[model samples]
Target: MWKIICLLSAVNTAFAGVEKNFVNFGGFVCPREEKALGRCLRDALNTYIPQLATGVAEYGVPPCEPLLIPALSVHQTAGPFAVTSSYTDVTVQGPSTMRVKDVTVDSEQQEIVSKLYIPELKMKGNYKLSGQLLMLPIEGEGHFSGKYGDIDAVVTITLGRAARPSGPDALTCEALDVKFHIGHAALQLDNLFGGDGELGNAMNKFLNENWQKLSDELQAPLEEALREFLKPLADHAFGMLRADDVLGGP
Candidate 1:
């Protein structure tokens, strides 16, 4: 997740019309005196934000799998059950609108900070679980879907010169590091472990009751998953332009 944010920021200056304004990284000489560079970055984001929010970015298993329940112990009126399950073939539906509140640069630190609002994120996948429900054998395979609401995150990105010098103008930047913190995130599970819908609904109720704890447990894995999911897309898009050409600089 951090790397994704860093990579995204590193290419901001590569957006068309902003390359000439050599970012004031440490002590780089910027020829352009105007604020077009800032505008360029914002414009680039505007174009992508809408695309990501409304676009259907497809992903496959091995990379994106259904949410797995590490462990679940529930006491129901019918009975108690402890279970573990795995989901595969995941699909993520991005928000309808991804709003970027602001993008600020700390030249000295080479960091770009941004505030973003995601209206919603929807996901669906298939799952298989083997466990005991009401002390009875519960093994099944079915479909599950979930939606995250009003997510807000703060992303910080640090960029630096590419490790190897290649461009004729020696204008290339790479993502050095990135930090992403989610401020407010709410998730709702429509159906999970829905072998027949009843079990799934019951599980959803259990999850809602222990949402915070579950979130904490899944945070690390979720971050790793997000990073893997976005890396290829970032690389493909960033490869399309060179900083010098985009900036119209020597």
Candidate 2:
């Protein structure tokens, strides 16, 4: 399991409305009305995607255009195919193009739910794996690349209050859950089985032919890794202000 710590580094610049005690970042004010809050939050997220992609240096937001993960390990022990794989120097592109189809924020429930769609996503990394895939012997250390299109994702965020010394309680991301489906995917692994061209070619062909099953087998661990990866970003963005400042009143 991956553990991520949420840290807030103070900055001189302010994005939240300090005097009004409401969310007013970049002129986008979140309405206090229950009926309108969800729409406002959705719009705000869509509007901020570009800025978030490039990152806000003053606010400590990291660039996400090509989100980088140094390393990730995934294991599938109880599936049609059991495998252990590790990926390093991973880069994922296309999140910045995500569109929110729907969103609901419930302050009382301390939860936020969103349905999102992405046109396409591209990933590249160095991978090492050892195990059986589709009952075929598999062992490799190589570079891998994948392209997925028409992705749909549902995300749920559970919020909690964090006590502050001088101010009202700030919001913290207690948990993040994500489930996603890919409409189509294409994958390739280089230098499979020590560069055995014939065997490697067959394996690659088999992988593509059975992409759906492979994706299913890997979904659980992949989603878990994604949730862990996004927690800090969520925390950093939400941790700067008190709960009321963002969702209490307009």
Candidate 3:
């Protein structure tokens, strides 16, 4: 009788995947279905994508006043002295409609691929520009806040083949690689300036007239911010899940 009981226990351990339990996501749940793991994981991700609105997102550059002017001329010296921006209330637009594009798993290679689509990253914030625009020394502040549209990124994560779970429930999984990219973006600066209303309006007009140049100047900084935003986003989505969630229990 003792030998039979030990043999039965070993058999159960060998076939654990066939009778595994569902994985939990803060509240979301995914069944441990080996054949349809990709879809299950994708569903789990969509359920947890709404946690991006709890903090301030900031971007800046040293001696930033010049970042607004298009580097069109080599002899141009007049530009803003400093520029800084901070945004808050950052939330995923269209949470109901947002979805994870796809998820792929390779047990042979111990890897997972996830695609996340964000309809928009909406936020409201303010920016200040303090510097000399001309020999006369002029500075202006603007409402540099708006919604960025159609942002998406793909994350590739690798699992350790020889790694073991630290506990009975925990799984050994880590994000080996994360890549972030942005599709479309827009900015609004209609109301900028604290003290000099007339000067602010004048600066706004100039920025509106040369908006393309301004956009060009801002591309790098904008990309930097997007990348920064993706880090937390990825952590929220991928960092919470463990190896058992994706590959079943050992």
Candidate 4:
């Protein structure tokens, strides 16, 4: 029986897929399913597709921000314990001394800041989501007790289906059963033709190099340095997740 128990545990380790049994976002490390990347992705999908449903089912165009996941669950061992840091009270030289609201952690070039805006993350939304995270073979569960770095964020989107006209198309799209496939995007003939191929060459270069680059007016401008970039990006991303939950977007 002991040998069988050991074998069962080994088989559990071998399981491939997202594990939803995680206690807290902090303890993403210990669970087997949450530890694998593939499983993590599956977990995300399972959480998303269902939330878009509105009695009517649809396969094609799915709604955006369909899942609304809560950040903190009081009963769980896990924590949205967002911050657990060590800081010393010391005077700084920026032409004057002051109490710290933000400071640089010299240990790893990581600067942990207590920002002016910390959104009150509430635990309510039309849709709820919880999923596994893919941290690779890092040999432990996900980060714990904090350090959920900015990218590792919890996000939820809600879209209420007020446009239910009625048929299979509605059901298909509602169910999010629709999928998109990318074929070759045809280049415009007139634009591609040039005296010396200059236009084409330039277009090609732009496509190859600056595909992600956009006009500053089109999107947010890139900040000059690291410190300049951190606050705004973090605020827009994590800080907005739970600011207010009473009213959710459709």
Candidate 5:
């Protein structure tokens, strides 16, 4: 019975891998003066003093900055195979605009000029995110403004796929192991908002209350965008695989 139980456990384990990751990146960069300056960026960042406070009754404009923290590069890795990939020739096409209220503000865009590579197939690649901050205010009741800005990333994913069958001389796998790539993609966040004022204190309270709104604002679009991009790519990639040889079991 024990041997049978062990065998059943192994068979019940799911077989699939679908995930990604980002490698080392700068958490902050000072606003750029000229687009021509390729390697120029600000160094000083106050991670400790800052705190993020969002939506609540104690509300007004939350004090924040309109700037971007630049990420030097974007990379992904698979945990099982330690397959690493970096994108290149990244572009955030000129004079882009993310409209907020009546104000149409202009911002800078950047790209990864050359492809960065890592040979080791560590379970995952590390990433430092360039954060964008915009404080919201009550221009009026129903009409408020989003002090909004975003950083663009131009990257290409470099990973591999293989197909397998359940039989003698069958291929080993149709996908990478989940433990290797998807599960290992890591995420981190840092935001600060404080001023020695009543409004600032309110801002802190609001953030503590409605943090989900802010997180969703940042994450939802990204999730949707990724799904849009990946769906077709996945269809194209897996569509090429031979659909015969494996018996079905649900």
Candidate 6:
């Protein structure tokens, strides 16, 4: 998520004068002046949020409204519980509503930093798990749902340039890092303990009650997943233009 924000900031610069080639990007380019770069980027991102949600097929970017993630696996062995869980066919909603609170670009260092907030996000999928929770045996294969709100994320992107045979050096994503906090979360896993309704309900209650701890435990993996997801998108967008064209002009 953090990566998404920073990448979008960089992509905004690439959109300068892109209207002639990509009509959807018209009117969304930020001014090249360093002084106005950050604010202009924030506004540009906000304006393009809707189009991005629906996707820009010409750019090979997928729709984000119900972002489809093939699978996610998490293994937690710290604290009082150890669990191995995998989710498939996951669909996430709410990123389209994200707002860029702030952005800073350091052209000299080729780094982009941004703060973003999402009002709420919901994820639904099928999950399979086996392990122990609170020293109790736990295992399940069923539908799962999660709702998260007030998500605040800080993202940093380190940019580099790649040699292009026919044009100026193209922009590349060298490294990306993201840190996030969720103000609240609610989770549910149906059909726990072989369809034991009591156990399933109790587990759901426990998960929601201790969501902060669980979220913390899962943060690293989640961040990694987000970074992986954004890298390709960033690369695809940046690969189309030269670094000089995007960031070196007046």
What lDDT tens digits, residue by residue, belong to model 5 across residues 1-250?
9999988777665321110111111333322222211222111111211221121112222322121222223222222111122212211211112111111101221111211111111111122222222334411011111211232322222223334564322212222211111111112112222223455445445544554344433232233333332233223322332222111111
Q: Between the candidate structures 1 and 6, which one is better when assessed by TM-score?
A: 6
How many steric clashes between backbone atoms does each model show?
2, 0, 2, 18, 18, 0
lDDT per model vs. reference:
0.47, 0.75, 0.50, 0.22, 0.24, 0.72
TM-score of 1: 0.51
| Candidate 3 C-alpha RMSD relative to the actual structure | 9.9
Span of 10 residues, lowest total lDDT, candidate 6: 19-28
Top-lDDT candidate index: 2
Residues forming the 10-long window of minimal summed lDDT in candidate 2: 1-10
TM-scores, all candidates, are 0.51, 0.81, 0.48, 0.18, 0.20, 0.77
Candidate 5 vs. true structure, TM-score: 0.20
- lDDT string, candidate 1, 1-250, tens digits: 9999998887884764464544432223233433444444544555554544334253221322322233232222323545555656656555325566665645455445556666655566565556654464455666656655566655554444332365543333344222344433444344444445786566556655655544433233334434443343334333443434333436
Best by TM-score: 2
TM-score ranking from best to worst? 2, 6, 1, 3, 5, 4
The model with the greater TM-score, 3 or 5, is 3
Alpha carbon lDDT at 56, candidate 4: 14
State the lDDT of candidate 6 residue by residue for 72-162, as single tens digits: 7888898877989888888777777778888787878787787888898787889898887778788899998888888898878787889
As for candidate 3, its clashing pairs are 81-131, 142-192
How well is each residue in 37-130 modelled by candidate 3, as lDDT tens digits? 7777777666544334333222121221111221111112325322333333222233233468898877666677777676765433344444
Residue 71 lDDT in model 2? 86
Query: What is the alpha-carbon lDDT of model 3 when measured against the actual structure?
Result: 0.50
| lDDT score for residue 199 of model 5 | 52
Compose the digit string of candidate 2's lDDT tens values, residues 128-232.
888998678988899998888888889898988888898788878888999999888888888889989999889989988888888864464346445654676
Q: What tens digits encode model 4's per-residue C-alpha lDDT throughout 1-250?
A: 9999999988887653233322112112222222242243233333332333331122222332221222222111123212111111211111011111221111122112221211111111121112211221111111121110111111212211222354211101011011111111111111233223575455444433432231111111111111222222222222212111111221
In model 6, where do residues sit more than 4 Å from their true spots? 1-35, 57-60, 217-229, 236-241, 245-250
Which residue segments of model 4 deviate by more than 4 Å?
1-156, 159-190, 193-196, 215-250
